[model samples]
Target: MATSVKNNSLPPSLISNLNQVLLSRQQHTIDHQSTNSSSLPSHSRNVDEPDCSKPLLLITNCEGIDSPGLIFLVQALLSDARFTLHVCAPQSDKSVAGHSLTVQETVAVCLVEMSSATAFEVSGTPVDCVSLALSGALFSWSKPVLVISGINRGSSCGRNMFYSGAVAAAREALICGVPSLCLSFDWKKDVSSESDLKNAADLCLPLISAAVRDIERGKFPESCLLNIEIPSSPLANKGFKLTRQSLWRSPLSWKAVSANRHPAAGQYLSNQQSLGIKLAQLSRDASAAGAARRLNSHRKNVEIESVGIAGKFNGQQTAKKYFRLELLEETEKADDNLDFKAVEDGYVAVTPLSLSSTDQSKIETEVSSWISAALGREQRN
Candidate 1:
C-alpha cells in the first residue's frame, strides 16, 4: 500500500521561493512592457513569440473570467516561473453547461487584461473556450503542456461532474490529447469565504507542480485526467487522498413561475432594449406581416367557420408555463475512498478519471503509487 502524508500546509522554504519567483516575474513583465512600448509596434506586440523554455499552461473556468476563484488560481500559478500562462474563459457564468458547444452560432472572443497572462473572455461555454483555444485560432500555441479547468466555486464530485462546465472544460482538453486538471473547492455558502479559495489554490500548488513536472518528463500517468477537490477548510485539512469517483448525486427540484417573472424574460427585455429602435422597427414590421398573413388565412377559412354551429368554441385555452430547476441538498454515507467522501472527511481528493473503460484495480494502483511518490516528504511539511 502507498503511504499517506498528513501535513496541513506547505513548507516555509517552498512558500518563500514561490514568492520570490513571483516578484521577479512581475518585475520582468514591467521591464518588458516598458521596452516594448518604445520599440515595438502596437499591433505586433499582442502577438508574442512563445517562450520555448517554459511549458505553456492554459486556464479556464465556468464562473466567468472575472471570478475570484479563477483570479486566485491564476495568481497562485504565476508564482511559478516554470510555466507560461494563458487564460480563455467564459464571459459569463456557465456553471452547469456541461460539455456543450456553441453550434450554428457565432461565438465572440475579446482580448482582456489579466495579470501578466495572455487572456481572452469567450462568449461561449467552458467547452467552447477550450475548443477555441486548442483550435489554434485564439492563441499562438496549439498545444499547451497542461490545461487547468478551475478552482471552481463548488465541488464537482460524483454525478455532479457530468453537469460541471469546469470539469467539462478540462475533459475537452483531455480529448485534445493534452494533460488536464479540474479543481474545485467544497464550498459552503455563508460559511466559506473567498480566502478559502486562495488557500485552496495555495494547497494545490504542490500537486499541480508535481503533475506538470512529471508530464514534461513523460512519467505522468497515461490516458487519464485528475479531478481534484479541495476541502472547505483548506489550511486545516488532512493530506492528499487518491480517490475513485462516487455514485452520489444531488437531487433536483423544479419550481414553476409566471412567464413575465422568469429571469429569461428580463434578459430578453434587457437585450431588446439594448438593441433599441432597430429591434422595435423589426418587431413592428414582423407583426404587420404576420397580421397580413393571418388575415389572408382567415379570409380563406371564413366560409368554413361561418358554417360551424353557433356558440361553438374552436380554440382551447392553455396555461403558460415557466419553471426553474435547482439542486437540492442531500446527505449520504459513502466509502472514505470515494471522491465525495474523501472531500467531506477533510482530505484533498485527487480522483483519476478516464474517458474510456479500463481495469479499475490497475488504475487505482497506478494513481496511488504515483501520488505517493509525487507527494512524499512534501506532504509532511
Candidate 2:
C-alpha cells in the first residue's frame, strides 16, 4: 500500500509531546550504555541531534559523507519536521562494494555534518553504516523507524541493483528486519544534474512521509526493500510507477563490449583469430557507447550513430575508452512494467525486493518426512 503526505511544516505539536515507541528486534551491539537507554535517540532541534521526541529516519549511502544530493535530501526531510533524520553514511565512496563487512579489521567512525544536518561517516561500506547505526553507535541509544540509502549519482536500477553498494545498504537494513528504501538519481551525459537531483529529493519527501506513516502504523512489509530511480528528466508533473526489475544476464559483473579504441585493446583484438570478429566487436562497442551517451542525455529523443573500426595492432598508441553502462534492461512491456524502463520514460520507478521467497509443498517439503529420510531409517525401523 502507498502512503501520502501534504504538508512540509515542522510538527511542533508532535515535538512538545514526545512519543516513546518500542524498538523492533534487530541487529545491534550488545555494547554497553545502550542496555538501559531508550531505543530512540535524544531529540534536540539543532538539526544535529534533531528530535528524540520523533522517530528516527536514518539516511545512509555508499557515496562519501559529503554529498550534494544527500545534503539536499536531508534539508528536504528536515523541512517536513516529521522525524529526526540522522545520516549514517560512508566516510568515502565505496562504489560497487556489495554487502561487505570488516569482520577482522577495526572500522573507524566519526561525526560529520552536511551543512546543518547531523551525520556520521563510517569508515566502511554502506552496509557497515547500517550495522553500526542499528547497534546504537550513531544515535544516543535508539533505532530508526526507517532506513534510506542513496540519492546516488547514477541509476542503481535493474542490473545495477546487484553490484550497487547503495542498494546493498538498504538490503542490509531489510535483513535486520527493518523496512528500507534505496534512492537513486540517473545521470545526464555522464554527470548528475542539479535539477534532476533536486527533483529527486522533492519526490523523496512524499515517499519518506508515506513510509514513516507505514512504520508508525506497523504496516511495513518485513524483509522487503523499496528501490526508487529518479531519471535525469525533470519529474515536476510525473508520478511514481510500481514496476518490476528487468532481466540482464550477469548484472553483477561488467561486460566489455569494445576494446578497439584503447591502445592495448587493438593489440588484444589482433590476437583474435579473425579480422571480421575484431570489426564486429568494435562496431558493437561503438553502438553501445553511442546509445549510452544518448541515454545519459537529458533529452528524451536523440539520434545516435553506430561506429566500427578495424585493422592495426600496437599497444603504444591509445584511443578513447568506451563502455556500455548496463543501466536499464528491456522487456516486451518495458513501457510500464520494468524498473529501468520507467526511469528512462521520465517517471519515478519504484521496485519492491524481498529477502526470501516461498517454496511449494511436496513430499520432500514435509518436515517430518524430511527428518525421517535424513536419519536413513523408515518409521517402522
Candidate 3:
C-alpha cells in the first residue's frame, strides 16, 4: 500500500535542520577535508578505501517534468533524508535515449534546493550525469555506492531492454563498479496518472533501500544490477522476487489507401505469373468486346480503385510504427509476469547483470563447478 504522508508536505521544523545539513555539506565540499572526516559515511570519505561506509546514492530520472513517477520517487528519496542523495537528471524527459550523452551542447546543472536532500538537475543524459556525479569534481566520494537510474514514468524490460535510459544509467554505474538500482512501473500512455506513481514509489523506496543496505554489507555478488519493476496495483504484491527479462509482440498493423493511384499495381505484381494463363482463358471463351468486359470485371474484382479525383488526392501514408522503447517493455513485461492480481500487487524483480570487463565464460564456469564436486562427478560419471 502507498505510504501516505500525514500533511503531504514537509514539516516546518525540518527546514532549518535541512539547511544546516546542506550548509555543512557545502563547507565539506569547499574544505575538501572529507578525506579525514570519519564522521561522514565511510563510502563518502575517499576512494582509496574499498570498503565504503556512506551510501552516496545518485538518483536520476529520464522523463523530466512529465513523469509523476519520477517526481514522486525523487520526493520520497528526499523525504527519507538518509543517504547522501545527489541528482543530475534531465530538465525534461529524455526517456529512451539509451546511454547517449549531450556532449556538444552546453548542459546545465542547477541545484534543486529540496527541503531535505541535495538534488540537482542536469541537461545531460542519465549516464552523463552519473559519470559527473561519481567523478571528484561534481560530488566527491570515497568509493561510489548506489546509483539509481529512475523512478521512471515508464518501464524497461524484455527485448527493448537495450534502449532504456533508466537501465542504461544503472548499467553505467555498474561499469564504474557501483551497486545500482533501476526502478520503473507499468504505465499506459493514456491511462496512468500521478497518484498511481506515488503509490508505486511507496512500495519501491523501502525495498530499494533494503537492497542498498545489503550491497553495503557485501551480500550481493560482484557487478550485480537490480532492475525493479513495480506493478500499477500496489496492494496485492508482497515485495521482491528474482526474475528474467521477457519479450512481447504487440498485434497491430497499418494499411495505406489511395484512389486512382494504380491500386491494381499491387494485385498485378502479386499475380504476374498467372496473368498470362488468365488472359488466355479469357481469349478462348469470349469475343473481343466480351473479353474486354470480362477483363474489366476481373480488374475491378482484383483491385480497389480510388473513388474519384478527390479520393486519389486523399492518399494516406500508413506504416506500422513500432515503439521499441525499453522502458515501455520493462513496464509491460513486469506487469504481465509479476502477478499484479491484488489491489496493490507488485513484485520487485531482482535481475543480476554484468558490466565487468572479466570474461563471462570464466564467471559462468566458476559458478557451475566446484573442485571437489567436479572431481567426484568425473569419477562417478
Candidate 4:
C-alpha cells in the first residue's frame, strides 16, 4: 500500500484481523507446536553431514532473523545437501505485514543462539513466523518439508504482491498444505555485494531444488503457489518466466510528518494495540515502479524518519501520531502476462497463488444474497 507502506503503524483493520487470527490457528496450532518441541530448529548434528533424511528448511523473513537476505539465504541453504536450515523469524522488521498475527501482545519464541541455522526469534508476524513454524510452535521432531520465504530485500514484484510479509510467508505455506517458495531481491540487488550475495544465492539454487521437487512430487494445485521474482541483474537476469498476477497500478503516495523528536513517538501514542506499528512515510516506488526506469531523481525518495513502535511500549505514555492509507487494489484484470510482466521484461518471474479467491461464480448467485440478507435480519428479530 502506498508503494509498500512508505511507513506503517499497524492497523489495516488490525492487519486484517491478524490475518484472521493466523487463519484460525490453522489446525489447532499443530497440537500446540508438537507439545513445545524444545523450541524447534537446533539439530545440526553433522557427523560427516549426517543426512538424517534432510528436508526441513522452514526459513522465513520480512527481514529479521538476521537479515542479509536471511544470512545470505542461510549460507546458500547450507550447501544444499538438500536443505535443513530452520528459522522462524520476525523479532523485528515486520515490513508491510500482510498475513499478520501476534494478536494481543506477548508472543515471544526465542531460541536463536545458533551455530548455523535452526534459528527462532519470534515476537511475531511474517505470518507469525509461519504460524509458529507450521504449528509445531517452534518444532521438535522437525516438520517443515520446505517453506523458504525470502532471498526478499525488495522485489516481490508489482505492487509488491499485495504488501508482502515475504509473500505472506509463502501464503502461510500454501495454507498449511505446505508447498511454498517465495524468494525476492531485485530493487537493484547489490545487497552489499559478497559477490552480490553469492549471485543471489546462486540465483535461488534452482528454485530451491524446484521447491523440494514440488513437495516430493505430490505437486499440489488446489490453490498453490511459487512466487520467485529475483533480478537486480542476477548474472544479468538468468532466465525464468511463467507469470500471472499483474494488476498494474503503482505510484503510491501518502505523506505525514513530525513525530516530535521521534522516540517511536512515545510508543506511537502509547500503543493502540501495536503489532509492530512502524510508520515514518515517504517512498517513491523504487523510482516509479520496477525495471529500474533510471529516473534516479536522487534515487526517487525513500524515507522512514521515524515510527516503529510495535512492542515494548508498556503503555501509559502519550504524545502524537498521524496515519491513514491502507491499499488493496485489484478491481479486475484477470491477467495480462502478469507477475509484473516477467520482472519488467528481464525475466525471472513465476507467479501462481491461491487461498480462496471466492468468485465461485458469485458463490451460488452473489454470495447467497449476502447470506440471505444477514439471515433475514436475524429471523426478523
Cα lDDT tens digits for candidate 1, 125-224: 9999999999988777779999999889887999999999999999999999999999999999789999999999999888888888888888788788
In candidate 2, clashing pairs total: 5
Best by lDDT: 1
**Ten-residue stretch with the least lDDT total in model 2:** 19-28
**Would you list the C-alpha lDDT of every candidate in the order shown?**
0.85, 0.69, 0.61, 0.65
Candidate rank order under TM-score: 1, 2, 3, 4
In order, how many clashes per candidate?
A: 0, 5, 19, 6
Q: Best by TM-score, which number?
A: 1
* Per-residue lDDT of candidate 3, residues 1-381 (tens digit): 889766667777898899999999999886786555756644333323332335766677677633566667778876776665556677776777787867767878776654344666777887777777776666655445677777786556554456778888888788778877788776667777778778877776665566556567765445457676766655556555555455542322343344224455445445664877878986997898998888788765553333222323223322222222221122232443332221124555544456653665554343223222333333464
RMSD of 1: 19.1
> In candidate 3, which residue ranges exceed 4 Å CA deviation?
1-54, 249-346, 356-381
The TM-score of predicted model 4 comes to 0.29
Looking at model 3, report the run of 10 residues with the lowest lDDT sum: 319-328
lDDT of 2 at 368: 24
- The sequence of per-residue lDDT tens digits that candidate 2 reaches over residues 17-71 is 4432212122234333466355543332353354678877889988888876777
Residue 325 local lDDT, model 3 = 20
Considering only N, C-alpha and C atoms within 3 Å, which residue pairs clash in candidate 2? 39-142, 43-51, 43-52, 44-50, 189-296
Query: Model 1, stretches more than 4 Å misplaced?
Result: 1-48, 263-318, 377-381
